[model samples]
Target chain A: MEPLLSCENVSFSYENTAVIKNLSFHVNSGDYLCIVGENGSGKSTLTKGLLGLKAPAEGKIIRGSDLHGNEIGYLPQQNPAQKDFPASVFEVVLSGRLNSRRFRPFYSKEDKKIARENLKKLGIEDLIKRSYRDLSGGQQQRVLLARALCAGSKLLFLDEPVTGLDPIVTEEMYKLILELNRKEKITIIMVSHDIKASVLYATHILHLNFDKSFFGRTEDYIKSPMGKYFFSE
Target chain B: MFNFAEMFQYSFMLRALIGGILISLCAALLGVSLVLKRYSMIGDGLSHVGFGALAIGSAANFSPLEFSIPIVILSAFFLLRISENSKIKGDAAIALISTSALAIGITAASLSGVNTDIDNYLFGSILSLSRSDLVICIIVFIVVMILFILFYNKIFAVTFDESFAKANGTRVGIYNMLIALLTALTIVIGMKLMGTLLISSLIIFPAIISMRICRRFKTVIIMSSIVSVVGFFAGLVISYNRSTPAGASVVLVNLAMLIVFYVIGTVSDKIKAKKFLKQ
Candidate 1:
């Protein structure tokens, strides 16, 4: 089967300044690909490229025809601007279905069912009528994850999803992501600042830095020199 | 003491009430998204642009809405683009455009010597709404209402998170332009009732007031509509009774409603906190 996503020699930039240079990767169906990098390491930019929010300066990004734009789910990092965002959990999740339908004034019953199902999957079904901002950080992440699931179950891209989460919540979020990958067989591309956590959950690892990077199976990544340096000390 | 039935008998008063209600409803509906997106000031800026366009139209002896609607829409699009592409962002860009348009409008009004009409545009004279203005107000209201309903979810998505909406294949730019155009038209029509100086209150005060008491997007929108219509109606009545400026009275009514809602929100929070503590 063709890969779900493939980026061949892709270079990305902002304002003519290159952030990602000649990066290449492919994601098969059900693959849990974790992108590990330091701050400002182009992880978010790479995902933005794949999402078509930003066009690559060089090379090609191939998303399967069935998996373009609104067909791919995304969970961006938390921000203060959305702190007081006035939305019910139901409304937030239902918006994810906007990409699936065309020219409809409101959501269909099928969309509502899908939203409800995703909320249940994330164990947030009870929050459907609750205010999104009233929830705790973990609940908000779950709500967002449910929304992403509503967009597309075939692929998910999460950018530092647990950045501001507590350790226990982080572990739970990772478990939830793992469940989606393992049980639902969803493809995941997660940008993570925690190398150890990436090694723990990822089947494939793509390490990015200013100058050089590594891309391979998690086992090989663990034994690699840079990985040795990271894991040993 | 005001006689509501007697006030309704006057044709001008009827026009003012109808036009004011329609304008308020439209502005309130669109206000939720604008407030959420931090583009509330865009309404203020675009209204200033409308003032300039109106001045030119009055001086040129043309229909003001014809000139102002398109011009304000263009300026709104320009503001959106500048904020997106240029280093000068949100509030700063609005202030720059707003002051420039205000200055140009005032200067043009002075040169043209159309002082009375300009004053009507500046501070509003609801009692002076022409039949044509009423007709235009109704048509604009219908268009805005229909477009807002059809694209409600899309607008909600865009307002909540533009990047996420884009990633999800919603054309962020097109929807943004749609919002700008709708808001611009609403502002143009609304300037007649609230004037250029105070019209943004029509687009802003309701959202803030509703947000005080409502937590959900749809609830906030619904509440805002109620607040805006009621406030506009009450303000019209007050202005008619006291012979005050319709625009200023409407703004004051809205401000009063905001205070009421703020108190309600505070009280509710206190009660909830007490309940939680008892538990």
Candidate 2:
């Protein structure tokens, strides 16, 4: 199958220091690939480059064979701005519906209907009118995920998606991701710091160790000596 | 050249004064989102762009508002697009567009030999506004007020988070572009009374003051409008007393309010801390 996204020898630097070097990888349709690394290991930087939020100083990112903005949705780690912004949840979700078509002509009531359906699907339709800033971390994460889903995206990108959740909620979050992947055949690429927990949910793993990488099936990696060295289990 | 009393006595000055009040109301209303989103620079930058466009419009024998309106809108749109890509910091992009437009405008005015009227654009002439300018200002002010009332939810949503907005299917780009267009309109119409250099003060100063004093979003907006209108009245009175420019005096009055609010917020915090120790 044609890969959705391919990065060949992708590299980036900040002033004199290199953050990512000669990093090359690919993601395919219906693949839930979780990237694991320590802080400053370039996980977030890699995702940012993929989303076109940042420009890599060197290397190339070939997209749409795997995913594009229209086909890819992202849930950023921190929405520090959303705290002071006074917008309702309903309005927040509607913004995801953008990039569908320009000039709209007349908004299909159908799209609005789908947005509502997505909110309900995330089990937070009751919080639809509340200020986005008021929600708890878990709820906000769910809301943001729903918003990402509203884009009709076939692939989802989540960065540190379970950072502040309780164990049960984290379990539920993983369950939800699995459900989406299983039911909708949607591809998910996530940058997760939780090495052990994420292993349960991820189908494939892209393990980055500064200048080198281990890319293959997650189960195989768990049995590999490198995984034991890194995860120590 | 209208005389001071003649300017005061004529219905036109009265209309301009009232027009300034209305336009300033729109500025204060929009300022909440602008300040909170840290896009007060968007207003400031676009207003400067409008100033340049206004100068060229007058020098080239075209309608200043006509030339200014589109260019201001385009700059606002560009700012929004740049913001989404996040290639450069939003503040940096705002500064780049803001200064470039101002430079272009200065060059255009110099080349056209219209330096004499530049002061009117930079430091608005309250005594000489035309009847048509007054009417258009009022119309633009009303249109701005109505759009805010109608689209407050969508505007609030996108300003808070563009991606979250896009994910929810709210036409994030269109709404963002629309906001830029609205901001450009406010700046263009407002330039007639407040001038380019000082008008953004009407949006930002009120917000800075309100955010310092008010706790809730509703309270913040109300306080901003109140602070602004009061500054207008106080400035007009001082301008009359000092025989100075009304627009410039108004800006000084805004600066004064900022100082007062900063002191009050600081003192209040000190008082609360002292009470906590006593308890």
Candidate 3:
């Protein structure tokens, strides 16, 4: 079967500084592909290109018209409070239900149901009533994760989703991600700075260096020069 | 002693009450979204821009609405365009547009000899307004309502995340422009009751006060409307009795309520923390 997402030779640059160069990757259905590179190695560019945030200067991305009707759910790195934003946790999470339907202004019963369920799944159900700006770093990360979950997407893309969380919370978040891909049958693509966590959770890995792009199963990549360089102690 | 029954019997006072309520509802609704998107200063900027536009309108013998929309639209178009680029920070961009528009407005009023009645623009005098002003208020209220309903999701989504909204099918530029245009138009109409200097207080004060108490987005809007309605009428009454500027009194009432809400928020936060600890 053809992959759910396929990018062909995607290249992008900002004014002449090439961020992504001749990059190509295909994300299979239910594949947990964790991408890693040194900072500014086009990891974010590829992620944005996948979501069509920045159009490629060179290639084509075929998401194939919403393969299952629900598309991508993305949780960017920035916290809602870091922006000093003024929305409650429930309000922010419910916003993720934007694509669910429109004729009504208020959140429907099903919308609340999905949000409550997602919060429960993420183990932060009690924080549903709290203000998003008032939460700590770890709690905010969980709330954001549940918000992304409320989108009811088949594929979830996270950009550095677990930065600043405590070690225990980080483990829980990564474990939750693994469960999302394995049991929920969702495709999870993320750019993680934690190489050890990437090795611990990712089913497959993509490594981009200044010259080459490498992609394979995680076990096979344990010895690749790019992988060793990234995961080196 | 002022007689309340006398003011109640007057047609002008009645229109002020009705127009004030409707306009309050419109501003309160849009204000919530504005606060969330971190574009609070746009309200102040557009209000000043409206003053300039109003000056031009009076000078050229045209309706303020007709003259104001184009100028505001032109400025809003540019502001929205520059926002996408990181060339200048957000507040700097807003400051640049706001100061320029304000300077031009002052210069236009001065040069045109258009009888720059500061009272009319600052504190809208009920005694001087004609039937046309009421009609304009009604039209503006309807326009705000229509815009709010027509692009509900698009507006909310844009406020939530600009990039994500663009990534989906929503046109961010059009929505941003629509918001700015409506804001500029609202400020122009708002100036009739509020005056140019104080109209932004009308947009933000209620939202800021209600935000301290409310947890829901829609609730904040509803609460803000209630706060605005109460403050506007109370100010009208006080201004009548005390002979103060109507615009300034209304703004003062809003500020007082904001302070009260601030105290309440602080006290409640402590009480909640105490209760949680005791548990």
| Best of the candidates, DockQ | 1
lDDT of 3 by residue, A177-204 (tens): 8998999898899898777788888888
Q: Tell me, by lDDT, which candidate is best.
A: 1
Q: Candidate 1, A147: how far from true, in Å? A: 0.5
Q: By TM-score, how accurate is candidate 1?
A: 0.96
Q: Which is the better candidate, 2 or 3, if ranked by TM-score? A: 3
**Candidate 2 interface RMSD, angstroms, 1 decimal:** 5.5
Candidate with best TM-score: 1
lDDT of 2 by residue, B93-172 (tens): 77887788788888988898858668878887676467887777778877887787666656665666665455434566
lDDT of each: 0.89, 0.77, 0.77
Task: Evaluate model 2 with DockQ and give the value.
Answer: 0.15
**Model 2 collision count:** 16
Candidate 3 chain B minimal-lDDT segment of 10 residues = B162-171
The two-chain DockQ for each candidate, comma-separated, is: 0.81, 0.15, 0.47
* Model 2 TM-score, 2 decimals: 0.66
Chain B TM-score, structure 2? 0.89
lDDT of 1 by residue, A58-81 (tens): 999998776765688889887677
Candidate 1 Cα outliers beyond 4 Å, as residue runs:
A65-69
